[model samples]
Target: MSVDKTFYVTTPIYYVNDKPHIGHAYTTLACDVLARFKRLDGYDVKFLTGTDEHGQKVEKSAEGFGTSPQELADRNSANFRELAARLDCSNDDFIRTTEPRHIRSVQALWARLVAAGDIYVGHYEGWYSVRDEAFYGEDELVPGPNGTKHAPSGAPVEWVKEPSYFFRLSAWQDRLLAWYEANPDCIGPQSRRNEVISFVKGGLQDLSVSRTSFKWGIPVPGDDAHVMYVWLDALTNYITAIGYPDITGEFARYWPADLHMVGKDIVRFHAVYWPAFLMAAGLEPPRRVFAHGWWTNEGQKISKSVGNVIDPVALIERYGLDQVRYFLLREVPFGNDGDFSHRAMVQRMNSELANDYGNLAQRVLSMIGKNCAGQVPQHGEPGADDREMLDAAHGLLPKVRDAIDRQLFHEALEAMWGVIRAANGYVDRQAPWALKKTDPARMGTVLWVLAETVRNLALLTQAFMPAASGRLLDQLGIGPDARTLHHCGSHHALKPGTPLPAPAGVFPRFVEEEGAA
Candidate 1:
C-alpha cells in the first residue's frame, strides 16, 4: 500500500484502576512501532491510546486509596501519560471516558441503538464481576480455590439482581457470523479469531448494558438509576475521538478505524460487542482487531497480589527506553505469551543490540574516522561481495514490510537484523583495516559496503529503536529525511565524501552479575 493512504490504529484504552505495568507498555510500544513505521513509509496515520477512566474497579480502588474517583483518575491518568512519554509512544490522541466528548458520544450511541430497538429496559439477574465490570453466565463461572467462585472471564463474581438495560446481542449471532465470514481478517492472529468464532458459535446471550450499583460510569440517557456498562462506555471512546456525534469533515475521514490492537483478554469486547454495537448503529465495523498476548514475570503469571509485576518506568530507567522497546518486541512473538526475565532481557541487549548492531555501527564509524578521514568513502566499483551484501540488504525491505503489515513484529525485527548480521560478517571477513594498508581502493570499497549497510540498518531500525538509530545516523552524517523505510534498499543514501561525525557507542554491552561475561 502507498504510504499516503490513511491508516488509523489504536491500543485499547487501559483502565486506570492500577498503575501502568510492562504488559501495558508492551502493547503501547507495539502500536508506537507500527505507527512510526507507517509514518516513515509516508502514510497518514492516526494512532490512538488512552486511559479508560470510569469503571467499578476504578471506583473501588479509588475508595480504598481514600480519594474520589475523579481524583484517582487524574493521578493515575498522569502516570499513564508519563509512562507513554517515557517509552516514546507517538499516540495522536488520548481519550478519557470522563471527557465531555466521550460522554456525548456514548449518549449518542445509546440513543441510536435505542431508536433502532436494539436496546430494551429489562431486569438483570446474573453473576456480576465488579473487578471486570462484566456480567457472566453460569457456564462461564469457575470454582475458585477459595470459597468464592470467580468468573472464568478473569473477574470476581457477585450475585446481583437489578432493573437495568440490555442489548440484543443474542439476536445478532447470525449477523456476526456472516460479517466474520465476509471479513475474514476482521479478527486477527488466527488463534484469536478461532476463539472468538467458537465463543459466538457456542452462543451469545443478551448483554447487560447498564449497572445499577456503579455510579462512577457514564449515566444512561434518561435513566438515573443505572450507568452505562463499562465496555459500552469504553468502546464509545473510539468514535468519540473522531467526533462521532458531530461527524465533522475530519471525523468522517477516519471513522472506520483501520486497526484496533488490544490484549487477548478483551478480544470478545472489541471483536464481538463493539462490532454488534456498530452494526446496530448502522456503521461499519473496524477494519481489523488484533489481540496480542500477555507478559509474565519469568514464566510466572504477573499479579498485583504476587507483587511481581514489571514496571515500564523502572525498566526504562534501569535499561534505556529503546532497550525496553526492543526487548519487548524482539523477545516475544506478538501474539504469544512470553516470560519476562531480567536475565533474558539483558542477554538480548548484549547479544542483539550491543554485539550485533552496536558493534557493526561502532566498527564502521571508527573505520571511516581512521582510514577515510572522518568522511564517507567514495565507492570505486562494486565487487562480488559488495553486490551480494547489497542484494541481501535490499531483499530484507520487502520481507520486513510484509511481516510488519501482518503484525508479526518479532519476524519483522529478525528479518531486518539478518541484514545487519550479514553486513557484520562481511566486515569481519573483509577486514577493512588490513585492506587499507595493502590496497587503498579495496579498503574504500569495503568501507563503502559497510557504511551502505549501516545506512540501511539505520532506516530499518528507526521504527523500533529511534534513539539508537538516530545516533547511528548522526555518526554516519545521514540527514533526518534520509532515515526512512522507503530509502532502505537504495544505495545512494550516503553522499560520497560527506563529512562523517565522530563515532560514539550507540548501544553499550549489557553486563549482569559481578564477574560473568
Candidate 2:
C-alpha cells in the first residue's frame, strides 16, 4: 500500500532523577527503529525523545546529591542525551521540561484548561505514593506486610491533606469512553487497550493537577503558589517540542502524533489521562498509544533496589552496538516482556550474525572479488533455484513494510533472515566455488543473485542495525539514495559492473576474554 501521511512518534520523556538503564534504552531504541523505518518508507517523520526534568523525585534526588534542582536536572538530562548518542538514536528533538519553550507550553496548556473550567481549586486528602507520584483511591490500596497500606503498585503511600488544583478527569469519563469506543484501535496490542477500558469503566476521580507542596515544577498560571502536577508538566513535552499553543507551524504539522510508544507501567497516563487533557485543550489526541512490556535479567526481575539493573553502556561495550540492538529487537515480541541473559545474547550474536548473515555476505563477496575482479557481476539465464531465491529476496520489502507498520520488529528481521538463510542454502547446493572451475558463466549468475540479495538485505537491515548495515551497503557499493525502501523490492537492484569495495565482515562474533581469538 502507498503511504502519504506524516509519521510522528514520541518516546516517553524519561525521568531526570536517574541515569539510563536497559529499560530506558529499550524504549528509546524501539522509537528509533520505527522512526528510521518510516523515514526510509518515504514518510515525513518527526521523532521526539528527552527528559522529564521537573518532578518531586528529581527535587529529592537533587537534595540528596547536594545540588539545586536545576543543576541536577541539567546534569541528569545531559546523561540522557549522551545515552541517545551512544545508542545512535536519530531523534529530531530532545525536549526538556525545564526549557523556556516547555514552561511556556505547560503554562499555556494550564491556562487553556483553566479557561475551559477543567481546573478547580479543591482539598486533596488521600493516600499519595511519592514513588509513583500518584494518588491511590481508598479501595485501590493493598495491605502491606508491616501493617501499612500500599499503592496497588506496591509502593508505600502516606496520607496527606493539602489544597490543590483539580482537573475534571471525572467529568471526561463518558466522553472518553465514547471516544475510545469510536476509535477501537486507539490503544495498541489489544491487551493494553483492554486495561485502559477497564480502568475508565471502573471510574475516574477528578485528578489533582496542581501540587502545592512541590516547588520544583512549573507554576500554575495565575496561581504562583501552586505548581502544576508533574505529569501535567511532563506530558506537555510532546507538544512543547512540536511548538504547541502557538499553532500553525510544527505544531500544525505534527501535533497529533501518529504514535506514543510508552512502557506498560504508564499506560493510564498516555492512554487515559493524556487524551483527556488534549481534548480539554481543544486539541486532537494522538492516533495511538502503544505500551510495551518490560525486561528481566536472567529470569529474575531487574530492580534498582536489588542492584540488578543491566547497564546498557556496559552491554554495548561488551557486544557491538548494532549486535546488541539486533538481539534486543529480535529476541522478544515487541509488546511482551523479555528476559536479558548473557548466554542468550552471545548465542544469538554468534549464530545469527556471524554464522548466517555474516558468513553468507563474506563468502559471496569474497568469491565475487576473487572471480569477478571486485565488481558487481552480470547475471545469466535464471535457473529454477536462482529464480526462487531471487523471488524470495524481491518479495521481502512488502512483508517488512507490513511488519514494521504494526511494530512487529522481530517479524521484520525474521523475514530478512529468511532470505539470507535461503541464499545460504542455495550457495551450498549450487556450489559456486565448484561452478567457478566448471562453468564460469553459471558461477557469475549465481554470484549475481546472491549479491543482489545481500544488497537488499543490507538495505532492510538499516532500520535495526544501521551501523552494521552501513558497512554492508558500503561493501556492496550501493549509493546513499538507493539504499531506501523505495528500491528494496527491485529485482535489478544492484547495478552490474559497479566496482565493489574489498570485503570485510560486518557483524563480528562475540568471544569471552578468557578465550581470546
Give per-residue CA lDDT, model 2, range 347-390, as digits (tens): 99999999999999999999999999999998888989988998
Residue pairs in clash, model 2:
none
Off by over 4 Å in 1: 1-4, 513-517
Error of 2 at 172 (Å): 1.4
Report the lDDT of model 1 for residue 368. 87
TM-score of 1: 0.97
Candidate-wise lDDT, in order: 0.88, 0.90
TM-score of each: 0.97, 0.97
- Relative to the true structure, candidate 2 reaches a TM of 0.97
Q: Could you tally the backbone clashes for each prediction?
A: 1, 0
Q: Which stretches of candidate 2 lie over 4 Å from their true place?
A: 1-4, 515-517
lDDT of 1 by residue, 218-326 (tens): 8999987899999999998888888898877546788699889999999999999999999999888999999999888988989989999888898888888889899
After TM-score superposition, the amount by which residue 208's alpha carbon in candidate 1 deviates from its true location, in angstroms, is 0.8
Best by lDDT: 2
Candidate 2 has its poorest 10 consecutive residues by lDDT at: 1-10
